[model samples]
Target: MAELESPKMMPKSITFLSSLLQRVADSNDLHREFQPQKISVFHGLTRPTISIQSYLERIFKYANCSPSCFVVAYVYLDRFAQRQPSLPINSLNVHRLLITSVLVSAKFMDDMYYNNAYYARVGGISTIEMNYLEVDFLFGLGFNLNVTPNTFHTYCSYLQREMMQQPSLNLAESSLNLGRSLKVHLCFNEDETSHQQQQLAV
Candidate 1:
């Protein structure tokens, strides 16, 4: 089999993307950064009510696409942001961009998957709106959706490292929280209580 090609990157493109994500997460006042003239007037009207993390989590839970599709979607998002500086990943456009990127990624990576209308339902948008967003997102990405296994692994590893570096809840705090939650289940029989605890562990 022929080797797959990877997208080119600058010296600090990944770092830049990471910082940009931190900025987005740290601040919600994006409307001030970008002028109304820069974005589609309609996007201002169609701003997402939910956080980007929540929206992406919803897609991951329902889309049923390969895990790699998410990594590819991230790549596509980065490319789109780089190419279209004016349309930053702000509150107004993140949800649409997320849906379009994930849809395109699933189409590119999965041999069998849902159609646009199905994805539209998953994304809480109309079929017509989903179609329009897909087209505009593709153009913004310059239709460069190809992602090699190497690039995918690189991104995945980068994300994993970032996750590992973040501070986690200590065992004492976790145990205290778990103990509080288990107090509510004292009424159940032993077997039922054990089963419920198992489910909670999962």
Candidate 2:
């Protein structure tokens, strides 16, 4: 239930994720220039004028999902990349991919979320296109949306480790600890689910 807009979550976490994704997308786009790949539904005719960081910040501002959804969305992106190696994350596709992945993440991880049409508006795409992207994205992953606690922790740790490698970011120790804290929260939710089941039996 932790909002990404909270003062404690702002700037650092968002900046770290945006920078990380930008670096990946830029590198992939450069590689694709030399070695062309098959285009997927996620691709756009032209690269978005908006930067990855700004796009992510916009999503954070409006999506109203918990901070944890970003982490989960990153996991989904990685999974999709691994599953669909032919369609890599590049400049042309990254924006659409990001919007779809984050939207899917919010739907799966958060109890309260907006419809695809709302997310499509936030992503600057037509609702019809958003619907197409959602269906295609789900199939691309073969509907593997579940993230185990261990997988979640591993991704969180990987992201933190990547951030640590860049001293220029000057990320605080507390900020780095956010991943572990989120993992703990996930585990608590599992316990809560079990408690709900017990109450139902009573």
lDDT of 2 by residue, 1-202 (tens): 3345554335465568787666656656656756558978888899889999889888888888888898889878877876776787778888898899999999999999999988998899999999999999999889999987756666676667666776343222332354321011122233454466568679
Clashing pairs in 1: none
For 50-93, candidate 1 gives per-residue lDDT tens digits of 75555666676667787777778877877776676566565666
What does the lDDT come to for candidate 2?
A: 0.74
Compare the candidates by TM-score and give the number of the best one.
2
C-alpha RMSD between model 1 and the true structure:
17.9
Off by over 4 Å in 1: 1-31, 34-37, 41-47, 167-202
| Candidate 1 lowest-lDDT run of ten | 180-189
Clashes of 1: 0
